[model samples]
Target: MKETEHSNSSILKEIAELLNEETEIVAMLKGALVKFLNGTNFETGWIFFIDAKGRSELVVHENLPEALAHKDCHYLKKGGCWCVSRYRNEELKKASNIIECQRIESAIAADVGDHAGITHHATVPLQSGQERFGVLNVASKDTVRFSEDELALLESVAFQMGSAIKRILLTKQEQEMALVKERNRLARDLHDSVNQLLFSVTLTARAGIEMTEEDTVKEMFKEIQHLTQDALTEMRALIWQLRPKGLENGLLEAIKVYAEMLGLQLHVTVSGVLQFPSRIEETLFRIAQEALNNVRRHAGVAEAALYITVTATDILLVIRDEGRGFVMDKNTKLLSIGLQSIKDRAKAVGGTADWVSEIGKGTELLIRLPY
Candidate 1:
């Protein structure tokens, strides 16, 4: 009576806190998982999220058995368990109570650990309306059946989780859309203003060079003209990258065109299919552009090669040049700006960048992005 009412109040308070949370989805999920455990007698729990590809990934978990934790149990890596399979098959549309856990059963059968202690659990679908997000599973050490009220409470929490997940996803989409609009606006402004001004400056410098009779004056005009031309090329490249043409065809095609425009010999090799999130593809394209810019301005090499490997779990990009390489050190400040930008871009996509360079040995830039 009083205890149940107190528990319900705690659950409601947690739900209110969850509704007010503005953190990232993963962090919010972790908080909600903790709240769920606090509201129930379950000693352990986990959440799985279904991605765009319909693949179930173990996104969060709490308080697993020592043996399972030691084994580094990854449900996605193991191709999911019975609850996930049933969820995918649409068999567990509502709160499933006192069901056998095949994962724990298998672990016990193989003498994996004291997993026999966890014989069964209650699984519920985290969904809102017709949209399904994933599943939430909770289990206890002692064999205890959940009551009807407890199951209803779990369903309510799952609903809130689903709503939060949906809101976060919508927020991300809005942010991405906003970013694209801003990029387009900046691209247009650069093309109409700075790009036109640079073109005029190039023309004026060339005319001045032709009209000047003094050799020194002519040389200065020539230098001005060269600088203007270089600036114009760089500006055009920036505009093109800001709103890349033929990106829909794919990143490889776009890179091929860019390399052609730069008049650099490009050798491209691709292994496996190249498909990735839009942000990741965009980041890789920008990094490749930066690498090519380095090759053009400093490499002193006529050719470069780009190797790309795409897998279900990760994407690898490698750009190599047999050009005049320079010593890299934080104190020296040589090409640090561009390299740092590459690193930042890789990090933005949850990836990493490595630069291998030595004087007279050329340079190789490697990037790995995991999805």
Candidate 2:
């Protein structure tokens, strides 16, 4: 009883620690898994989360080989011992000695624990209120298995573990839905505003070009040409705004369109495959927009390169301009808004943006994001 009380207090402290940490969700989850797995009483631990299709996926495992984790799956409704069975019933503590628990022999066999001397096991249902979140399974190589006291410790921690998982899953779902809604709203705005304005401008430019003679119309023609170019630029921007940014057709298409408009000598190139989340793609597009604006407004060079590559599951976006670069300290006052906006957008989506440039060697931007 004394040991059980101490374990309960320790678990409560862990829960408080998790709640107080200002780390990213992924890092927090990894930390939680580590603590759970390294619990003094268990030889192995695993956490299974339900995926989009309602199938259980092995999200975290400690001491379980990759071969077993990848090859097997557990479904909630299918009566799986580790995740499904625990959730179906109300019993929070299900621990058994190797000789007495014949029902779970197959699970033990599938886990390949017979040779590892994993004789004692326990499966605890992790729940937040009435919601069935997931399961935490712990095993011991010794036949002593889990005592009633140990089971009490697990029950104490289960509440905190379940709540954290529920919060993370709900947060991800809300983000995805919000992003889809925002995309729909942007589509409507582009059609209603940009499209109509560009159409009227195109008609006026065509009429001016057709009705003038060479001597008297030289200045008119120049003005008409300028209007035409402006209309084209606006049209391209609209298209960029509306482009369906899938993994295959996102950044490459944007760069290609910009290159065609700016001419072939601009030399835009993309390296490495990109598979960006929708929110990440939108931010990347905005970053590219700002970079191109800088190239056109301040960069006084003929060539620019947009190199994209993935390094260790991270997307690295490098936008380089062979133009005269300005000093950061001097330009911060003038360029603060644009630069700050870009940096904030990147950070919001778990990314970092940096710039490297000298006075004449050209400006290069590096945007790093999770892939």
Candidate 3:
């Protein structure tokens, strides 16, 4: 008995260490599964998470049986398993010992011939207070019923996992809020300080141009006025991109405003409703900003067309311009900062950025992002 208690203590200590080392929920769950299987009698373990759409998803697993794994388990697919259904229905509120797994039972009833040695399993809901994260399930080949102490230990681990998940989620929300606050602050500072200063400089330079008598002095003042106006334009674009008021309406509106600010005639066509996660919205906006900047500096075109198509699973953005196009392969080593930024932003959001360009023809930039 003392040895068993020591072993349980060691398991809890190892779990604490693993949780401390990991911050992301998926990585934390994967590490916890390995530690749990190594330290306990449980032969297999898996985690399920209820996504934003309220779909039960099998996120990670360890040491799953070959029969189940070979069958490409149905639970891992889009639909929910019996355990998750029971949990969702509030039938299985705690860790319960079972004589059979619902998945195996269904397979047998359906005569799928995949349930060879699968039998009993236990499931514990990973929850904290009123929030339900998902479930932690463990199974073994032997049909031995789990002990009270064993079930209790599993519940304790589930509690820890739930708490960690909740903490991480809250931390992420706080961080995002802080970022929005910082961006708003920076936008205000730029508008009130740098933006106003540039306007003052442009006005002063124009006045000097008119006041100067000598042609050389007048030309110098004209150059200063032109440069100051250019600086003002760039600063305004940066400020708007940082905190676009139009974005509150939607991404399409924001892009239209930005293009207008850049003095580019924009033709925009958007299909489907505009509803997306904040991260995805921000990513698409950044990519569009970079693309438009490239159009202004390199494309030397006055007009561009943006086509946006939204679907249930993904968002596609295409920006095309009939401007002077450059050779991509020869200039690969000389890719501009704007182009690099566009590519990086797309990749960061699990998306792809590709373009087709031909010399003296036109260029098309395409970006696809999964929601």
Candidate 4:
């Protein structure tokens, strides 16, 4: 009797430990409840969450035979599930007699092969402070299987679950707010840089237009068209940069968009065969954007090519320009900001940037980094 009592205490302690270890509220509760059911020889268990849209969706369901799970999905969406009305009305403290009050007696008891055996149900609402997260459900073959002690244990588990979920939700909300703030900051920078540059270009073209010659008028019109197109491209680029969501389309897609925008605006035939590390795709995308922006500004050449190659261990980017080469001098802001930005970005991710140029020849920026 002493050995049996000690073993039972150990099992209870293990269950408590398991419950305490989960960081996510729903996951931990579902795991503990499922383990409790499976360990104590119960038939099935489930966890459901009340979504923002007030829909009672299944979060986790375990040991429920395939047929029952399938049926539950249908019922979870429809009003067929026992907890539907309870969840909809926010009645957490209601009596756990969902199945006992079932109107569909024959439908509930119908045998769906091996899965039809489980009939008894006990549901406990997962409450955290004043808010209710969802419900914990357990089913058994034997009627009246849940003792008062078991009910208390289930409620305790739900309480723990609610606390964890509350913390996670708060953290996620804070993170989203921070992301919105950062996007706003980037938008301000883009407006200041691109808009200011276009304004200057507009003033230069207007001055050229006032010159009294037919050839001068044609040249000024071309300049105005080029500057206007560059401004539009810059606006598109900034919009994409500030989107702040969904990397599923990945870095290569962003790069292609950036390159296409540059090709449409600039006199250069900007083209690239870009491929890079799965892990460093974002970094590579930023690097390419910065490099191209520099090409559009300082590289007065009408022709440039961007080539990206991925190898066994590293990704390489080469942006070459047949433009008026830049002088690497302390007075040169373009060389400093543009090259330094690429260099620092590459270095931040354990990469290197090599800039090769002469006064009248051309310029080539080569970046190599581990994937």
- Candidate 1 C-alpha lDDT tens digits along 239-289: 887888768999999898888777788999999988778878889889999
Q: Candidate 3, residues 1-371: lDDT per residue as tens digits?
A: 99999999899889988877777989999998899888988888888886455567678888876545645665344333667777778676788786556565555455644544557678898888888988898877665488898898898888888888888888889998998899899999999999999999989988998888999999998898899888988998888777877878888888888999999999998898878998899888888888988889788899999998999878999999999987767635666777888888888877998889888887899999988
Error of 1 at 66 (Å): 2.9
Ranking by lDDT: 3, 1, 4, 2
- TM-score on alpha carbons, each prediction: 0.84, 0.52, 0.80, 0.54
- Please report how far candidate 4 places residue 139 from its true position, in Å: 1.5
Q: What would the per-residue lDDT of candidate 2 be over residues 1-371, giving only the tens digit for each residue? A: 68757766776687658744623444665666567656556666666554223445456666753323333532212334534443445444333222343324444555543335544457666667777755666666654556777766666666667677667767778887897678767867775777667666667766766776665575676676687666656565545555434325566686656655654245555566666666667788778776776776578875678877775557888888878986787644545566777788789866898898899888988899764
Q: lDDT values of the candidates?
A: 0.81, 0.63, 0.82, 0.66
Each model's backbone clash number:
0, 0, 0, 0
Highest lDDT against the true fold, candidate: 3
- The reply for model 2, stretches above 4 Å from the true place, is 1-164, 212-221, 224-228, 242-254, 258-286, 330-335
Regarding lDDT, does 2 or 4 come out ahead?
4
Q: Give the TM-score of candidate 2.
A: 0.52
Model 1 residue 50 lDDT?
68
Which of the two, 1 or 2, has more TM-score?
A: 1
Measured over all alpha carbons after superposition, the RMSD of each candidate to the real structure, in angstroms, is: 3.5, 11.3, 4.2, 16.1
- Please give the distance, in angstroms, between residue 216's alpha carbon in candidate 2 and its true position after superposition: 7.5
Q: Which of 3 and 4 is ahead in TM-score?
A: 3
Model 4, which residues run further than 4 Å from truth? 1-30, 38-41, 52-54, 75-77, 94-110, 212-217, 220-230, 233-371
